[model samples]
Target chain A: MSERVVAAAEEGQVVELRRSGRRPRAVANGVRAAAILVALVVLAVFPLVFSNPAVTTIAFFTLVFMTSTTAWNGFAGYSGYIPLGHAVFFGTGAYTLAIVAQDLHMPGGYGVFWLVPLAGAAALVVAIPFGLIALRTRRHTFVVITIAIFFIFQLLSFNLGITQGSSGIQTPTPPWFGGAFNIPFYYVGAVILVLSIAVSWFIRRSRFGLQTLAIRDDEDRARGLGVQVGRVKLVGYVISAIPVGMVGALYAYFIGQIFPQSAFDPLFDITIALMAFLGGLGTVSGPLLGALVLEPLQQYFTVSDPSYYLIAYGALFLIVILALPRGVVPTVGAWIGNRRARRAAPSPAAAGEASGGAPGGTRYAATVRSGE
Target chain B: MALLEMEDVRKSFGGLQALSACSLEVEEGSIAGLIGPNGSGKTTLFNIVTGYERIREGAVRFRGTAITNSTPERVFALGIGRTFQLTRIFTRLSVVENMLVATQRHEGWLRSVLRPAGSASEHRRAMELLDFVGIARLADAPAGTLSYGQRKLLDLACVLVADPSVILLDEPAGGINPTLIGLLAQRIRELNRQGKTFLIVEHNMEFVMSLCHRVTVMDFGKTIVSGPPDVVRSDRRVLDAYLGTEEADGDEAP
Candidate 1:
C-alpha cells in the first residue's frame, strides 16, 4: 500500500497519504551523508602520513586548477555563456602579481597576497566591457567575440613592454618561504580550494543562480517572465572572472616566473574549459572532478612530451563533447537514480491490491487503489 | 471617458499596413472582445495598444495618460498585463515560480540578492492566483511539463499575479480543448465580475458571442463594427469581411 501511494504520487495523482511518523528515509539519507563526510575527512587528512614534498606540490597545483575550473564551469555550464576569453582574466591576474612583486619591489608573500584580489577586481573591470559587447550577440557569435577579445589582448601584451612582452616578468619568491619545499604552499592551495567550493555552493543556491538557469533554458521567455537577461549575464560573467584571476596570480607567484606568452597562453583557456566541460557544466563538483582526474594526465603529458600535450588534450575534448554532453555528474546521477528505482521490487499496483484486500481497506487505501 | 482609447492608430510593417488608421476604446471594468478573420489586424491593434509594436500615427491614451510610444515593460508597470498568442510561460520554472516572477514587488536586484526570498505574503498570493486559475495542484510541477491547456492557464495565472487593472489576452481559447474553453470563459467572466477589465482576441465565435459583453470586428486594418455581440454578429460589413463572396451566396441558400 505504501509503495502504491508512492507510485500514485509519482504519476501526479494527488494522493494524500497518511503520515506514518516513521523516519526510515530520513535515517537512510543521514547515514548516506555521514558516510560521504567520513570518506572526505579521511582523504583530506591522509597526505600527512605520506609526507612527500613532490606529491604535495603536485596536489597544490591540482587544487589551483580545480578552483579555476569550478568558477569557469558555473558561468559556461549553467548560464550557457561560452566564454572563450577566460584567459584574459587569468592572464591579467598573473601579470598583475608578477608586476607588483618584480617591478614594485613590494614585500614578498603578503604584498603578492593583497595584490592578487586586486588583479581579480581588475579582471572584473575588463570583463564588464567585454561582456557588454559579447552578450549583445547570440551563441556562436558570442563565442567568436570572446575569442577575438582574447586574441586582441594577446597581441597587445606581446607588443607592449608593460608585461615584459614575450620574455615575461620574473615573480619574486617570498623571503620567508624561499628555502622551504612544499607544505606551506599545499596548505594555502587547499584553503583556496575550500574557499572556491564555498563560493560555488553559494552561487548555485542563490537567487542569481535560479535566474541564470532560467536564462539558459530560454532567454526570450525568461525576458517575458521579467528576468533582466543582460544584467544577469553580465553579473555572472564578472563573478566568474574573480577566481580565475586570483588563481593565475597565485600560479605566477608559485613558479617565480611570468611571461606574456606563458601568461596569455591559449592552453590555459583550453585546459580549464576542457576540465569544466568534461566533468560537467552547471554542477558544483564537476569542475573539481575534472581538475582532479585530468590534471594528473596533463602533468604526465608535460613530463613525457610537452609539445604533443595539445594533441592529447584536443582528443580528450572531442571524446567528452561527443560522449557526455550533459557532463559527468547529471548523466551519472540519472543513471544511478534509475538503477535504484528499478531494484525496488513488486509493482505498486500489485502491492496496492494486496493491501486493499486487508479488512475493508482504509479510506487512504481506497484513494491509492483508485490511482487518482 | 474610455479607460483605454486608441485614436486613428496607424501601424505598418514596410508595405503591409497592419493597422490603417484603426480606432477603438475599452471601457473600465468590461469584458471586451476583438474578432475577425485571419490577418484582420486584431493582434496588430493589441500590439500597438499594449506598446509591443510602434504605431506610425496615432494617440493611445490610458486612464488619461498618453502611452503611444511607451515600452512594453513600461506599459506593464502602468497596469497593463498581457498574455501572448503562443502562451509564453517560463517552461523550465515551476508553475508557482512563473507566477512569482510576475508578482508586484519593490525588491530590486540588490534586495533580492541580500534577502532570502521575501515574506510569505508573495508566496501566499502566488498560490491564491494559481488556485484561482485551477492549476494549484500543479503548482510545484515544472510549467514545461504541463499540457497545452494547462500551460495556457499558467500563462493566465502569471498575468493575474501582476494584478494589472486591465489584461490584454491575445487568445484565451486558441487550440484549447472544448472543456478547457468553457472553463476559461467562466474564469474570465468571474474576473470581470470582480471588476477586472479584459480585452481578449479570440477566433472562436461561439465562445466570444457567449462571453464578451461587447465585440469589436475588424477587417483589412479597419474596424468593421463595434456593438453588443448580437448586433455586431449581424452587421453586413462584419459578414462581408468574414465570409467574403460566400456571405451573399449563403444568404440566398439559408
Candidate 2:
C-alpha cells in the first residue's frame, strides 16, 4: 500500500511536468493576442500621429490593397484558382459608384457612403455571370478565362459613352483639404479592411471554407466525398467580390477621377495575387501582412521613380520566389509549427520538416499547393 | 436484394472500350468482392456508379431508386460513399477534420457557414470512428504525415463518417502491408457485422477469398465468373483468365 502511494506520487509529478511543458506555448498564444491588441490600437490612431497628407495618402492605399488582397484570398486562395483578371469586378464597382452618384446628382459627402454598399452589391451581381463562365474551366484555363473576361470589360469601358469613352469620370472633390482631407479616406479604408478581415475570418472557420479547402487540395476527391464544388466556388467568388467592390468605390472617390484603363488596370490582378503570394496564400492573416509590408514601399517607389518602379518590384518578386518560395508568413508559420512539434514531441521527422521549409507550411498554405 | 446495381453498364474512352456491357450487383447486407486484372474497368464501373463519368448506355439503381446520371454529391447524399484507389485524403487537414468533411453533405453551404463547425455529438462520432480504425492517437496530426498504409486507413475512416448504407472501396488493400491489411479486414468484418454493406475492388486474391461472402471476377471489361469464394478458387475459367491460357510450364493463377 505504501509502495502504490509512492508510485501514484511519481505519476503525478510526470503529469505535472507535461502540463508545465504546455504552459509556455499557452503563454506564447497570450503574447500573440496582446501583440494584436497593441497593433489595433496603433492603427486606430495612425492618421492623428502622422498628420502629413502624403503619409495619410500612402496609408489609405495600403489599407485599400490590404482589403482587396484579403478579398481575393477569400476565393482564389481557397479555391486554388489564380485569377489574372479580378480588375473586372473592381472596375464594375468603380463604375457603379460613379453612375449612381451621377444619376441622383446627390452632392457627394457622407451621403455617398450610403451608396458604397450599393456599389458592392452591384459588383456582386456582375460576378455571377463572370463566375458561371469562368468556373467551368480548371486551373490554368480558369486563369486564362479570367484574363479574357477582364479584357472584354476593359474594351467595353473604352467604348461605352456613359464611361466617357477614352476620357474619364471625375468625382466631386471633397470640400476638405490637406491632412484633414485624407483622414476620412484613411479611416474608411481601415473600416472596410477590418470588415473584410472579419468576413474572411468567419469563412476560415466555417464549413464552407473546409469544403473549399478540400476542393483546392483535390477537387475530384472532394467531389467523390459529396462536396458541391462548383457551388462552393461560386459562393466564394461572390463573398470575395463584396469587399473588393467597396474598396473600388472608395478608390474612385479618393482619386476624384476614374479612367477605363486605370479602373480596369490589368496590374490590379497581378498586384493583389503578388501580395497574397508574398505573405502566404489562403491564410486569414497572410494577405493583410503582405499588403501592409509591400504597399507603402510600392507607393513610395511610384512617387519617387514612376518609370523604374515596376522593374524594382519585378526583381523583388523574383528574389521572394527563390528565397521563400511559400512566402514569408507561411515559412515563419512552419518554423513556429516545427518548434511547437519539437516541444510537444521530440520526433525525428519534425526536424526534417523544419529544414525542408515547404510542405505543411500551414493548414491553409498546404491546400494551395502547386496547381495542375 | 441489391443495394447498389450497375446494370449493363457500358463506357468507352476514345477508341478504347473500357467497359463493354459490364454489370455488377452488390447485395444489401454482404461484403461483396470484385477482383480483376489491371485496366479491366473495375475502377471505371466505380466512377459510373458514383456519377463522376456519365454513362453512355446504362442505368444505376440504389435501393430501388433510379439514379442514372445523378451527380456525385447526389449519389453520396442518397447513401453511398467511396474512396479513391490512390487514397485521396486531404493532406493539409487534420485527420479528424478529414472525417468531419464527410458529414457535410446533409447541410447546405449557407446553413453550414452560419453554424458552428462540428456539434458535440458529431465530434464524438468522428473520434469513435477514428478509434474504431485505430487512428485516434493521430487525430490531431495532419493527414499528410500518415504512412501509405495509414493513409488508406484514414480514407476508410473518412468514408465511414457518413455511415452510408453502401460503401465502395477501390483497392482497400492494394499496397499496404500484411499487418494493416489484417487490421483493415478486421475492421471491415466488425462493420459488416453491424449490417453495413461493402463493395470492394481488390487485387489481393487471398484477402478476397478469405473475407468476401461472394466474389465476382472480371477480365477485359466483362464478368467471367462470380460465386462463392471456394467455387471461384476451383473454377477453370478463373485460371484461364488469370494465366492467359491453360499452361503446363510452371504457371499459376494470380
Candidate 3:
C-alpha cells in the first residue's frame, strides 16, 4: 500500500507522506538557523544603532517579558499546568539578588554579576518543594495552589525585615559598564532571551519533552506507560524557574530596586500566560512570538493610557481564547500544511479524508463528530 | 515458585471491598488466564499487582521481591508490564513514537535532549515492533488515527517493547473481530513459546481455553478456582459463579 504512496511521490503527487505531520526538512533547518543568526546580529547592534534611552528601555522590557513568558511556557504550557504563580520565582530571584548585593556589599564588575546565577539557583531550589506540592493537585487546583504560593511569598516579602519591610531593596550598579548601563543590561536581556529559546527548543525535541506532552495529553496513561510523572513534572517546574529567576535578577539590577508589589506582581503572571497562549502554547516558538507581539503593545498602552491597556489586555485574551484557542502559530501552520497538501495532490486524498472513505480517512470524521 | 505472586491481597474503595483476600500465582514460562464476570475484581487485582492500586493487606511479589506499594513506573522498571482494558496508548504520538516511549532502558535527561527521538537504532526497533504487530504501515500515523483493533495491536506492542518477564493483558481480545482475535491468539502463543509469561484477563472463554496454560476463575472479589482450563471449566464452583452471568454463554460454547 505504501509502495503506491512512494510511486505517487516519485511522480510528484502528494501522498500525505507521514501520518502525524510533515517531516523536518533540511531546508527548513537551514532557513531556521539563518534566521536565528540574522536575529542575533540585529540584536547585537540594536543598542549601538539606537542611543535613545527610551528605545533601549523598551527593548529591555520586551526581552525581559519574553524570557519570563518562555520560561513559564516551558513547564506550564507544555505540561498543561497553566501556573498562575511564576511570579514566585521571579520575586525570589529579585529579592535574592537584592539581598546578596546589599548584605555582602559586593562591588560590581564580575563580582556582583557572578551572583546572578546563584539567584536563579535559589529559585530552582525553592521550586523543588513548591512544585512537588503544587503539582499534586490537577489543573484547577494546581492554579489555586500556585496563586497561594505566590501570595505567601508576597506576604513574606512584606513582613520580613530582611526584605526591608516592603520598602524595597536598592540594587547595586555593576561597576564595569561605565555609562548608560542600560546598554549592557539590554545585552544581558538578549542573552537570556537566546538561552530561553535554546532551552525551549531542546525540550521540544527531547524524550523528557515527549514525556511532558504525554502527561499533558493524559497523566494517568503516562504513569501507566512507565513515565515517572511527578519526577518529570518537578524537573520541568525547576527548569522553568531558573530562567524566570535569572531574568528577575537582571530586572532588579536594571531597575535598581525590588518590592513585594512589583516583584511578586500578579500582572506578570497574566502577561506570561497571555504571551504564551497568544503565540501558541506547547510550541517552542509560541511564547517567543506571543511576547514579541503583546509586550510592545502592552508597553505602548501603559504609556499612553494605563486603564485602557488593562481592559484591552482582558478583551484581547478573551478574543484569543474564544477564536484562536490553538494560538496563531499552530493554527496558521496547519492551514499552510493543508494548503500544501491540497496543492500537491489537489483532489484524491483530501477528498477521501473529507468523505471518510480512504484507509486512514476516518480520523477526520471522528474529529468532527467528537467536536474536539 | 511463581514469577508473579499475590498472597491474600486485599483492596477496598471507600466502603466497598474490591478484592477480598485474593490469592493467585503466575509461574515462570507459563500463560495464565484470569476469567471472571463483570465487577469480579479481575482488573483491580491487575491494578494492585502493577502498582496502580495499593493492596490493603498482603504482598505482591515479583521474582520473590515484595513490590506491593511500588509506583506504576517502579513496577514497570522491575520488569512487569501491562496493558489496559480501555487501551491507554499515547494517541497524539506517532505509532513508532508510542513504541519508543515504552523502551525500558532509561536515558539521562541531558542525553535525551541531545539525542533526537529519531535515533537510527530506536527507530529500527520501533519499526520492528510495529511490524511485529502487523501495523508497520501505520508507524508514522498518529495513534489516534488508528482503528480500534489497530490500537489494541499497538497497545500489545507497547507492552512487549519493554521485554518484561511477565505481561498482564486486560482483555486482549475484547471488542476485536474474530480475525484479529485469531492473530492475537497466535502472537500470544508464539511469545509464550519463547518463554514470555502472560497473565490475561479475558471474557472470551474460547480464546482463554485454547491459548492459556492455566485458567483462574474469580467472583465477588474472591478466587473461586485455579487449575488447568478443562478442570476449571468443569468445576461446579466456577460454573456457579458464571451461572446467571453473561459470561455463561462464553463458557457454554467451548
Candidate 4:
C-alpha cells in the first residue's frame, strides 16, 4: 500500500492512494529494518564463535571494506562525483595514527583503538582543502582530479621523512595471542561499521542529503533553487573521507605497518567505487550489500587461488553490472516496487503496463527516491 | 520602489555580444515582462540578475544594495529566485523533494543539512504548494515521471517554495498545453495580487500582454522600449524588431 505508483494514468483521482499506502509501507519498512538488525546482531558474534584466524581476518577486512564503501557512498552516491582518489584521506589517516601513537608514547593494545575517531578527525581536516579544490570541477574531470591528487599523496608518503618510507612505520602489536588476536580488530571494526552506518542513515534523511542529491541531479538547477552547491558538495566529500580515514588507521594497527603501498592503495578507491556501483550507487543499503557480497568473496578468492581470483572476480563484476546496469539494489528495487504497485492498484495493468515505456532511468529513480 | 535593477549591463560570449547595454527595473509588487527575439539576451539578463553570469560592465541592485558578481544561491538568499529557459527540476528527486530542497527558506546556510529533509510544517507547506499547482497527488513520485507540462508546473512550484520576493521565470508558458498555460497565467496573476513580484521572459505575447503590468522589449541585446503592454504591442520599433528577426516570437516549442 505504501508503494506510490508512478503511473501517469488520469483514470481516477490518486489522492486516495496516498491515504491507503502510507501505513502499510511504514510497517513493511519497520519489519524489514528489524530483520536486518537481527542479521547484524548474528553477524557481530561471528568471530567469537568461529575463532579461526583466517576466517576472522576475512570478517575483519569485510567490515572495513563495508564501512569505507558506505562512507564513500555518502558523498559519491548522492553527489554523482566519483572520487577515484579517496585513498588520499585514507593514507593521511594511517600516517596520522602512526605519528600520533609514536609521539604520544602510548602503549599498544586496546588503547590505540581509542584513536580511531581521531583518525576520522584527521581525515576531515585533509578533506576540506581537497574538497575545496576538487569540488570545483564537474563529472569525469572531477574523477581525474581526485586520481591526480591521490598520486600526489602516494608520492608524498613514499618521499616523506616522517612516514619512514620503505622502512614503514610500525604500529604497536596487540598484546593478545593465538586465534583470539584477530577477534579484537574484528569487533572494533564492527563497531566502526555500525557507527558509520548510523551516520549514513542520518545523512540520507537529512536536508543536506537531499541537497546533495539535487546537486547530483542538476547542479545549476540546485544552485538556482538556493542550494549552496559548492558547499554541499564539499561537505559531502569531506564527510565521506572520515570513515575511510578511520578504516585506514584501523587497518594500519591490524597489519602493524604503515607502508605507503598498503596504506595508500590505488586499488582501494576502485574497489570501494565498484562495490558501491555493484550494490547501488546512492542508496544506503546498496553499498553495505555490495561490500558484504564482494569483500568476503574477494578475500576468500585471493586466499584460495590468487591467480584465478582476479579473473573470476572480474568476470562476475562485468556480468552483474551488465545484467543490472543500474546496480542490484535499484534494479531489484524497481522490480519489487513495480510488483507492489500492481498489487495496490485496483486494475492490474494500470500499475505497470500503463506506465509502460516510461523511461528506465525514471523507474530506477522512482524506486530509489525516499518518498516518506 | 524598484525591487530589482540592472544598469547598462553588458555581457559577451567570446566575439558575439549577448547583452550590449541592457538595463531593466522591476517595481515592487508588479508583474514585469521581458520579451525578445531568440538570442536577444533575455535569458542572459536573467542569468546575470540571478548571479549565474557576470556582466562585463553593469551593476545589479536588489532593494538598493549592489549584488553584482554574487553567487547564484546568494542571490536567491537575497530574495530573488529564478527558473530556467528549459525546465531544470531534479529528475531523480520526488516531486515533493524538488519543493523541499528550495526550503533554504528554512535555513540560512549549511545549517539546513543538519535538519531532517522534511519537517511537519515544511511538508505541509510543500504539499500545499503542490496542490495549488494541481500536482499534489504526484508529490511522492519521482519528478522524472512527470510530463513536460507537469515538469514546468513543478519547476514553478519549486521556485515558489522558497517564498522569494521576486521570481524570474524564463518561458513559463513554453511547451505546455494552452489549458496549463491558462492555469499558469491565473496562478501568476493570483500570486502578483498577493504582492509577489515577477519578471517573466516569454515568447507567447498573448500570455505576457494579458498577464504583465509592464512590458520590456529587447532587440540586438538592448532594451528598445519599456512601457504598458498595449503601448509596446503597437510600437513601430517593436514591430520592426519582430519582423526583422524572422518573427522569432512565433510559437516555437523550446
TM-scores (chain A) of the candidates: 0.83, 0.87, 0.88, 0.91
lDDT of 3 by residue, A170-241 (tens): 998676543376787888789888988888878866788878877887788777678888878988999999
lDDT of 2 by residue, A266-359 (tens): 9998889889988888887788888998899999889888888799878878988898777777777656544443454335564443433323
Write down the worst ten-residue block by lDDT for model 4 chain A.
A10-19
Best by lDDT: 4
DockQ for every model, please: 0.29, 0.47, 0.38, 0.53
lDDT of each: 0.74, 0.81, 0.80, 0.84
Q: Model 2: what TM-score for its first chain?
A: 0.87
Least accurate stretch of 10 residues (summed lDDT) in model 4 chain B?
B245-254
Candidate 1, pairs of clashing residues: A168-A259
Query: Model 2, stretches more than 4 Å misplaced?
Result: A1-22, A339-372, B247-254
DockQ ranking from best candidate downward: 4, 2, 3, 1
Model 1 lDDT, residue B254, Cα: 66
Chain A TM-score, candidate 3? 0.88
DockQ top scorer: 4
Tens digits of per-residue lDDT for model 4, B1-254? 59999999999999998888888999999999999889899998988989889876989999999999898988988889888888999988878989999987547445766788888998999999999988897786677767788888899999988899999999999988888899999999999998899999999999999999999999999999999999999998998888853455454525
After superposition, which runs of candidate 1 have C-alpha atoms over 4 Å from their true positions? A1-51, A176-181, A340-372, B44-56, B59-61, B68-71, B117-119, B246-254
Give lDDT: candidate 4, residue A239.
86
What digit string (tens of lDDT, one per residue) describes model 4 on residues A145-262?
9999999999888988988887789888778978688888888888888888887888888899889889989999888888888778888888899999898899988888789988
Interface RMSD of each: 7.1, 6.4, 5.4, 3.2
